[model samples]
Target chain A: MNIHLTDQPIDVAAVLASVQDEGAGAVNTFIGTVRNQSTGRRVVRLDYEAYDAMAVHQMRRVAEQAREKWPMLCQVAIIHRKGRLEIGDVAVVVAVSTPHRADSFAACQYIIDTIKQVVPIWKKEEYEDGSVWVAAHP
Target chain B: MKLKIALFGIAKEIVGSSQLELEAPERQSVADLIAQLRAQYPALNALTSFAVAVNSEYAPEDYCLRENDEIALIPPVSGG
Candidate 1:
């Protein structure tokens, strides 16, 4: 399991390499990027803030859940970015490897969906006129 | 009895102080603490979805509070 919160771009290929070993026949990845539009407004940039300790803890918990549900899983990597991000920036990256393709896909989806619901993170949208805090979740 | 509360994110800024000392009688339920919190900090009125955490873990509305416990008002959750 690998979890990272950093300004540096997430190394998707490198992370895949870590988990793609002999027993892992399939790997799945999900990349979340900063969207150019939101709620009918043009987004210029986004600033993400997270409680570091809680965020890391949440990631570890997600990984633990995946391992528990799927014993065949080989590895899981989840990385999130902090600080200001442009419209095209990569906000989150999730990759999972399992013995088969179906498990990889299911586990990847579960991790991403769970993260959206439980992670404690806030996003501020910077538009042309001003900025508005999204007021909820990672 | 007075209980201390800690605010985070927007709530923290609106309350002016990261922590506030609220006056509530002993053995008050978590929901009671919220009522006093909303009354004391009118700005919190805008926040409709806050979870009460006693000693850093989630507690239901019926959960009771003690003076020794540390209560946090968690803002709406966001993650992904």
Candidate 2:
């Protein structure tokens, strides 16, 4: 139950440790990075923002949903970074541990997907010539 | 009654403020608040979609808003 929206760089090892469990045989982790290019434009950087309190609340719901869906899950950790980010920087990390590999993988994917859909967080893409808020326009 | 609403992401940019206070008749619904906001800030209508959160949880359109409710304007989310 380690859900966090942090402003600092995410420590992958720390995130993994938070979900460590002796009963779990598999630990599935997903790390989302800021890619250098989006569409046809070369992204210079990205600015991430969150409605901090609501973001955390929604992330907790995502973890809860995962746990309910995957009874075998031992633990869950979701860490998302905010503020300025450069190309290749890690933006988010999702980790799930379970007795078997399949459950861990499924739960990890579900958590990340739900977070993107429900969390009150946003990222602004900065290209060489201009900037735009991702998903802002219809 | 007057209610204060929190703005985030593009909503904040569109309104040019992080928070705003608006006067509404008592027991107005969330949808009414949104309509009022759109009337005041037409730029909000340009977004793909948006949701209203009351006390950090997504509120239904028919949900009644109370004074001092921690309402937030949620623009289209793009988090990973």
Candidate 3:
């Protein structure tokens, strides 16, 4: 249960280390980074906002669901950055540890995927001429 | 009854505020709240989609609303 929503830059190393275990044979991680472009627009940066308490709670729910599916999971950690972020900045990190490599990969993927869909977090892309909230409109 | 809803991301921008206070009928469901909001803020219809969260969980349309429940409008999430 290492879910977090931080305004500061994400500490990927610390997150990975938090899930380390002596008995775990595999550790898997997923890092999401801001891109410089979207569609045809040149993105300068992105502004992320979250429903603070709910976001953290939803993230924890994702971890719990993953653990229930993969009981062998030894540990899980998820961190998402809020506020303005420049291109190439790390936006989110998900790390997990399990006794076997297959379960580690499966659990890690499930956590990130579920968080994307269920977490109450959003990112707005700032372009040279204008800005738009990502996934907000058709 | 009156209910206050927390808005985030695009919902905030459309409403021009992070928090919204609205009048709701008693025994209102999540779907009823959304319908009323859409009537008040037609701009919300432009959004691709959204979900209503009650007490930090993704609530269904039929989910009943309580007076003091923590409610939030969750626009399509893009967080990685």
**lDDT, candidate 3, A73-118, per-residue tens:** 9999999999999999999999999999999998999999898888
Name the 10 consecutive residues with the lowest summed lDDT in model 3 chain B. Answer: B18-27
**Quick one: best TM-score, which candidate?**
2
Tell me the tens digit of each residue's lDDT in model 2 across A25-132: 999999999999988999999999999999999999999889889988998999999999999999999999999998988899899889989999999999999998
Residue B40 C-alpha lDDT in model 1: 78
Deviation from native of the Cα of residue A42 in model 1, angstroms: 1.1
Candidate 1's TM-score reads 0.83
**CAPRI-style docking class of model 3 based on DockQ:** high
Provide the global lDDT of candidate 1 against the true structure: 0.79
- Report how far off residue A125 is in candidate 1 (Å): 1.0
Q: Candidate 1 has which clashing residue pairs, if any?
A: A116-B79, A137-B77, A137-B78, A137-B79, A138-B78, A138-B79
Query: Against the hidden reference, what TM-scores do the models get?
Result: 0.83, 0.98, 0.97
Q: Superposing every Cα of model 1 onto the true structure, what RMSD results? A: 3.0
Best by lDDT: 2
lDDT of each: 0.79, 0.93, 0.92
Docking class of 1: acceptable
Ranking by lDDT: 2, 3, 1
- Evaluate residue B56 in candidate 2 and report its C-alpha lDDT on the 0 to 100 scale: 92
Chain A TM-score of each model, in the order shown? Answer: 0.93, 0.98, 0.98
